[model samples]
Target: MSDIRINISNKTYVLAHDTEQFHHAIADLDFTVHPQQFVCLVGPSGCGKTTLLNMIAGLDPHFEGQINIGQATQSPTIGYVFQNPRLLPWLTVRQNIEIVFDDKPPTSLIDNLLDNMQLFDAQHQYPERLSLGMQRRVSISRAFAINPDILLMDEPFVSLDAPTARQVRRLLYSLWQKRPHTVLFVTHDLREAIALADRLIFLSPSPMRIVSDIEVPIAREQRTDEGCVEAFREQLLQNHPKISELL
Candidate 1:
């Protein structure tokens, strides 16, 4: 797959009641993510992170500039994991993932995805029957099952308890290692961003813009070590004091 290029000059949302009023969401933001790279967009809440992801995903298009995924001759598959686990209550875990494909996908594919997410035993259970963590795993499994060229995750683990969130993060990293896809994950948590991203893109408050683009120095394996990540974070803030205030 080709790299994902994003260039945004301006993006504004009109207020529902007032046509004259506009909410400036993003401006003068530009970045390109290489294929199979994991990048994190770190910003304060309501800093237009989700809006940018929506624009890239083609969910919202009324914005200036463009987002190109892969090559023009190829159709890039895009997968999204939103803030919540948006699963169909009626569908079992396996069925939820199966529904993404236009045709019936191979049973082996479904089994393997469930197995990887550690949900094989619960594959037959409905969304309502599973815990929040389990449901989130199903969501992640479904996203990867599509074998997306670009994966956009918007704080998928935000609502989980700390322990559960850590578990999910490790699971996501394991999955990404097995099948590396171009990923742009958005989150406000600096520690989470440090733990997952290969590169970190810090954004200004809305109308959002890029403030800093940094390559994560800690190795992927070392990220799981809390002391390493924490030390790096402390040094990072000490070096870039401005970024400290942005978050």
Candidate 2:
């Protein structure tokens, strides 16, 4: 388990470098993600959720404050799942997954992931031939194969149908349990946030800042069922009025 600490005074991107005009993206954001914790960042579109994730992943270094991930050193091992399954169309499903690794991971790990993700049958198939859901599954398998210490996901289920999203959520839960990592998942949907997060952090629109930090006590399984979902929704609406407004 690795602890994380983040303190961002501001996130600014120059819109017109020559004119020195900039867009203030995020401001005064402070938070922490405990080792192996599943934390969700929820806000309206264009908020700094993805910006923050990118900073943590070390993609954008032009931020104001400090982000101290556990064991501050060289780069940390990170797994990223984007809104789309960014698989290599030319590669076979198995090859697409293995390409991410610099050193070869054990055969058992690869076999287990392929078996668990139900991609064994499609391992030799190219990404273009598989259904969207199957391709996303392969993408997920690829992420886990790297054995990441921190996993960053940006609206991973965005374009999927409701049923497909639910199915993926279940598979995600199973995968997380198998190898728990410090996960920072971003989404604009509050309902989806409730379903996946052990801790919820809500952000305001850009320039963004933390508005609410909540610990979700509801069990993951309970949060997904129909009756329990409504109950959880009502509880959130009562307790966090701001969250409802954004939703």
**What lDDT score belongs to each candidate, Candidate 1 first?**
0.92, 0.85
Question: Best candidate, TM-score-wise?
Answer: 1
Instruction: Assess every candidate by TM-score.
Output: 0.97, 0.94
Candidate 1 lDDT over 150-229, as tens digits, reads 99999999879999999999999999999999999999889999999999999999999999999998988898999999
lDDT of 2 by residue, 1-247 (tens): 4578999998899888688888899888888899889999988888877778888888899988999987756467899988789999899998999898778757788889988887888889998899888888888888888889899998888888989888887788888888888889998777778778899898888899888898888876686676776687789879888876555
Cα RMSD to native, each candidate?
1.0, 1.6
C-alpha lDDT of residue 166 in model 1: 95
Badly placed stretches (over 4 Å) of model 1 are none
